[model samples]
Target chain A: MDKKIAMVDDDTDLLNIYKPVLEKAGYIIKTAFDSSEGLKLYKEFKPDVIFVDLSMEHFDSGFVLCHRIKSLPEAKKSKVIIMTSAGHETGIRFSTDTEEEKNWIKADDYLEKPISPRDLVQYLNEKIFKEK
Target chain B: MKIENGKILVVDDEKGMREGIRRILEIQGHKVDTTDSGALGIQKGIATEYDIYFIDLKMPDIEGTQVLREIKLMYPEAICVIVTAYASIDTAVETTRMGAYQYIPKPFEPDELQILVHRALERRWYILEARRLREEQAKHLLEVAHEQSRMRTIINALDDGILIINQEGQAVLFNPGFLKLLDINQEISIGEPVLEILPTALRDQIKEIFSGKGSVNAIKQEITIHPPAKLVVMANTTPVMGKKGELLGVVSVLRDISELKKIDIIRSQFVDMAAHELKSPLTAVQGYLELVVDKTLGDEPDLYDSYLKRSLDRTKSLVNLINDLLNITRLEAGKVRRELNRQNIKELIIDRLNFFKNDISERALKVNVDIDSNLCVDADRDDLLRLFTQIIANAVRYNKPNGQVNITGRQNTHYVKIDFQDTGLGIKKEEQDRLFEDFFRAKNEFTRNITGTGLGLTIAKKIVDAYAGKIKVESEYQKGSTFSVYLPFAKQNNFTIKNSP
Candidate 1:
């Protein structure tokens, strides 16, 4: 099952690393370096999942980019993902996935940076494939 | 001043008996008077109010008992002893009821009469002195009592708890604060040992240590008590001293430093977040850049060379920024481990000088190093290195190209001093006071295009404080600045400097 994925990061190198990996796994990848460009690209591509880096050129850019994409009528149900570094994701608070709030820009996945290619494929399979 | 014994009066038909009694009493320092006849004795008694009446028992004119009854009626306290014979001695029992010293029968021994007279005089003197002293002592006691009550009033009014203990460590006097702070209530009493007033550990610590050589030395310790384990507190203890330099007891103020602990938690969080923010990106940049230059550039030479050069340049910039951020965060966290080893004064300056070689050569700058090589100081190596980085980097950053930065070190047995003098744009005197504060940039930020985030001296000061050393800056607006650091010398072999690359 091929899926379309859009990723946004202010760090060009991190975007370059994940874009190639996602593309080879049969997921169509779209990239943006900052918030305004990422939102425009998100509406046009309307990808199955969105991965936003927490810090862009400005801090908290990922939250801004994710919120803008989810507010749109066409992308409300899209599975939004937050990509982070290992130091970023160890222990953060989250609600259970079954809640109705999951419909809008659901950050159902987290991928730690220097992320291995195998773990990423399995994660995408579990969130996008297993849901079916 | 003289009150006669008031018991002896001489009255005799025979003048010689009268003279003998008068001569003995007068010799014994008594005031005496005599008469020749009972009529004359009665006349003297009536005229001058004599204390005793002595007449012949068988008087030719009048009976002695009759005269005695008249004398008793006239002055009841007066003693009237009738000088009589042995045959008439049975009647002397009546004289006892009549208040006589005793009957002196005719032909009495002169010694017996003299002893009687002496006993009577001393009794009068003793009674008078006893009565006088009692009144005097009562007045003195009242005055002393008033002063003690005033003293207790003053001690009670003091906010600091006051306690006076005897050599036995028994709390002889403790103010209201002691009992109130300890929650002992009004049930506390005098003579209770201090241990009974406080928690068990505090009592033992104070009693054991405070009584020894530590009496003058400060007893600063933190104690924790748990009541079923829900709360925690930090207590700071300071010793209280008396005017004579005596150790009264310890005054411990237990404030709950829980908020300070929470701030520590928040600080560690900031360090973690900031470190993660800086390091994760740098790691990716380093790792991936190494991968690209290794794998992607396989002898195509020209194309690979272009990519390698660009990546290394950016990687180095990221590394420097990471280093700067690391230095700031670590110093702020107080994580730099410091040792108090004797550091070679010249080697420290030389090593520090060598580190700036690449940086200084790029700008063609010069630094004068004037410290002797033999001088060494006790200091922390890594901490001193970070200090050097901040000071030297600041010295270069704030200076013009080819500016002279002088680094000097001098050492005595007790202390070692180092100075980094730079001929650069000096700080304004107005900003000199706040030069060591964090995140404060000079007002002339625009005039001097020194690229700094302003955490250099702030971190440097903290490091110096860790060693109990001092750093001071002397600067005038246009006259360039000199920053001096003084570090106390610790014993040799205190610091073991490892192999340096």
Candidate 2:
């Protein structure tokens, strides 16, 4: 069975670019332009994996959505990934050493953007879907 | 003889001696008083400040030496002369030792008597004049000391730092204010070379002023103090010229302007960040389009479609950002029209809410409205509508799912207030003061994903200010936020809005 993945971002064009790239990697993908739409799609699709931009519809809205997904009993086994452009999106640096950082973002891994399609697929296969 | 010139007293047991002495002194231009007994002479001397006294050694009651002692003790400046008919060596030595000026025999010549009287009075005049001159000099010195103290007080009381340098670049005068402005210790004594005390940046300008170089007549410059304490100051240096218009030294005044410099730096930083923010989107758009042109995903419609959609969205966001910037510029420049009409407050808010119905339902957020429908205000309809839309839309967009948005409106005697309160990501206390400033968006983990141009609040504030209204925010980080707006009455009561701009 193909892995079910959902990606949420306000940049619809970026989503369009990411959607086919992820789809061609033998994963079924769903896309949303905002946090509200993303949450609705999450409930309907019950995706096995989630990819969200740190800034979408609102600053850190993706983090809030990720937290909500982790709190759900039905989605307990799902893998969540957070994306950002690092220096491009924000001026602050993040450290994963602190438990507070991991719990708040509720993501299993981070993907810095401007990434090629091949790198995105490889990162998912090795870090997320391989465990399943 | 005038008594004011010199008063003389003569005392002797023999009447001939007394009368002869008195006549000689009187003829020599002195007011002479004769006494037949030494006791009488002492009594007269006690009554006045006599300039000269002549006493006889062989007196019946008091001795001449005794009379001389009484007169000299009372008035030490009086010149005493002894006249004794005995003329013995013992009497002469005894009288001279007892404060007498000289000893003259009773059978003395007229010329000798006259010369003794003349010399005694002259010596008395010299002593009085010397005492008078000494007192005058003491008073003059006191007055000069008082004036110098007053001048020092005036210079030290000044707020601006002042320093007067000598021709050799030595600190001739360093006011207390100058030392404090530079944070230099008081132990740094005056007369030290200015190079040893002042920072190089300020010392250079002062040297330029003294050297009569570019704009040296009066030099004005901004300088930053060297580390350990970084301070900005506006230094004004002017040449202190002498009577011949020669450069004596330089007088420098320093005014602290670090606060203003800090504000200027912040404004410039925002401008740079704004430019970079605009360029970043362009760079991303260009990169994606180049990939499409390069055929990285050859013969694959799905792959190219995604890139093209992303490019289109980037263009759209870029347009939105430009529009936001234009609105702020126009509003700040006061180009927006303020055509006011009587507006039903609740109805306008409802109209704005209708535009956000989709967002509210999609988020499943509850909205509570407690507003008086009859409340009306004199305001421009479009401006009021936009104000409501932006504030309420922010409330919905930043709220958590299942959270609540509460709106309330009330009218008082002078103003009408509307509050949009939300259970959303709140602002930090430190960041709240700068929330309305242009390009100032909260940067944190929770605020990083927010989609905004950071110009919304700035424009909102400008619009509210045009109507002389006020907007304030209160929030607790991660708890919630409440934005309150107060719009004053357009005019007096019992009148409707009817102004056009």
Candidate 3:
């Protein structure tokens, strides 16, 4: 069975650009435009990996979505990643490397924007297939 | 010391006696005026105010004692000597009791008259010296009083609060500004303890100074007073030192910095928002370019065409964002050099609408304009163009397919009112108040596909404000929005167009 993935962002172009590239790598992908839509998609698709943009309808939309997803019984098997351009935008870097940060952010990992397709695939493989 | 050149008046009925005294006194460098009649002597004595007066015991016109009494009444400090051949102890004692300095018996030698004149002049010098010292002291006291009052006036007129406390922590002096800044409405007595009246933070700072725990140099602290109103103040307390290097008191100057603090917070927030707005587009552009460069999708060039096109679109929007940022910066910094002209509002709207011809056609949006041909506003050409472009751009950009945009202009006695009504996705009621704030954009399902820097309305509002105009909006969710701009009519406005050199 193929590993399933979900991407949520307000930028339609970004989703379009990344979807084909990720699909070419043999992973099934689904996309949503906002937090609520992303949450609804997560429930229906139950994807193995989720990529959420930090700023969508709101700046902290990803954080709220991540917390909602982590609260669900099905979320334990899924890995959630929060993507942000905040490091470039505000000069403030965020990380979920520590247990406290991971718990508070309710995210499995974090990535900065302008992320290349190859790097994103590699990060996903390391977090998903390598651990298994 | 003897004062030799005394001004002397001799009032004697005896010609020989008067002449003899004048000759002796004149030789001693004294200015002598001898009057034969006692009445004329009194007149001369009072007019000249001679330092010393010599009167005979008897006179025909007025008694010599009468002259003495009259001179003493007018010039109380005057030195008077009685010279009479009928001098006896009773008469001598009587004249001496009536402000007479001394008595010289008549039929005396020239030496006796010289000795009497010398002693009387010495006494006259002492009286004049004492009077001069008293006058000098009074004038000095008056100048000191004036200086103190001037200092008080200056302190009271200052906008910054001032408080001077004694070493005992008592409020020795305070100004009206002090009371207002501290929000103290009660009558503060001169010797009131300052710690009780001051806010806790400032009171603690003063206590630290009095306790000698901190450096004695001026301690500057930012403190907030919260009660009736929130006030931020910069309190600079320095020890007032005396000549002996003793701490006399402390002088605290409290300046209200609340406005500056608020501006500082706003400026930082604006910077953060602007940075975030800029970065979002850059991220997309960079990602698209990177995907093209890496050929992430495949080896086919056609696959990258759409990505490149999107990148180009993002770059164009980035450029627009930068331009908007610069325009806002210039507008807010008051650096826009205005070229004022009487511009017809209807004509301007028509011209601006032409810029959106392609968008209007592409979206199938109908634009109907019914504006008065002669309605005009006195404003900078570029400012009005930018203002119109922003509002019109929003009407077209946010409108649904086959939407209708209605623009109308009318004039009143003072203002020219122009309205741009668009069948567009209107703002939520809760978000309406923040519509004109910097980088504040409505984030909802309707606005999801809209690409904007969110600075258009902010810049529009700023430009309108610069022209002393007002811009407001009336809208209902999912229906449409009407943006009304009220600018003063060119002819009715009091704006003076400064001629450029």
Q: Against the unseen true structure, what C-alpha lDDT does each candidate score?
A: 0.64, 0.76, 0.86
**Tens digits of per-residue lDDT for model 2, B66-91:** 88888989987678888777788988
lDDT of 3 by residue, B183-225 (tens): 9988889998877878887777677776663347778999988
What ranges in model 3 sit over 4 Å off? A58-64, A70-73, A86-119, A127-130, B1-50, B53-57, B82-85, B104-122, B149-217, B224-231, B239-251, B334-340, B492-501
**What TM-scores do the predictions have?**
0.38, 0.47, 0.81
What is the total number of backbone clashes in candidate 2? Answer: 10
On a 0 to 1 TM-score scale, where does candidate 3 land against the true structure? Answer: 0.81
Per-residue error (Å), model 1, residue B41: 40
Prediction 3: B-chain TM-score: 0.80
lDDT of 1 by residue, A1-132 (tens): 568888886556556555655676668899876778888888888888888875453235565566677677887557778766524321221221344434443556555565544456668877576866
CAPRI grade of model 1: incorrect
Error of 1 at B433 (Å): 22
Of the candidates numbered 1 and 3, which has the greater TM-score value? 3
Clashing pairs in 1: B341-B378, B341-B495, B343-B377
Q: Rank the candidates by lDDT, best first.
A: 3, 2, 1
B174: Cα error in model 3, Å: 5.9
| lDDT of candidate 1 over B16-69, digit per residue (tens) | 788888888777666778876677677777666554456666567766666666
Query: Which 10 consecutive residues of model 2 chain A have the lowest summed lDDT?
Result: A86-95
**Range of the 10 consecutive residues with the lowest summed lDDT in candidate 1 chain B:** B492-501
What residue pairs clash in candidate 2, if any at all?
Answer: A13-B309, A13-B310, A16-B306, A17-B306, A55-B449, A58-B449, A58-B450, A59-B449, A59-B450, A60-B449
TM-score of chain A of each: 0.75, 0.85, 0.87
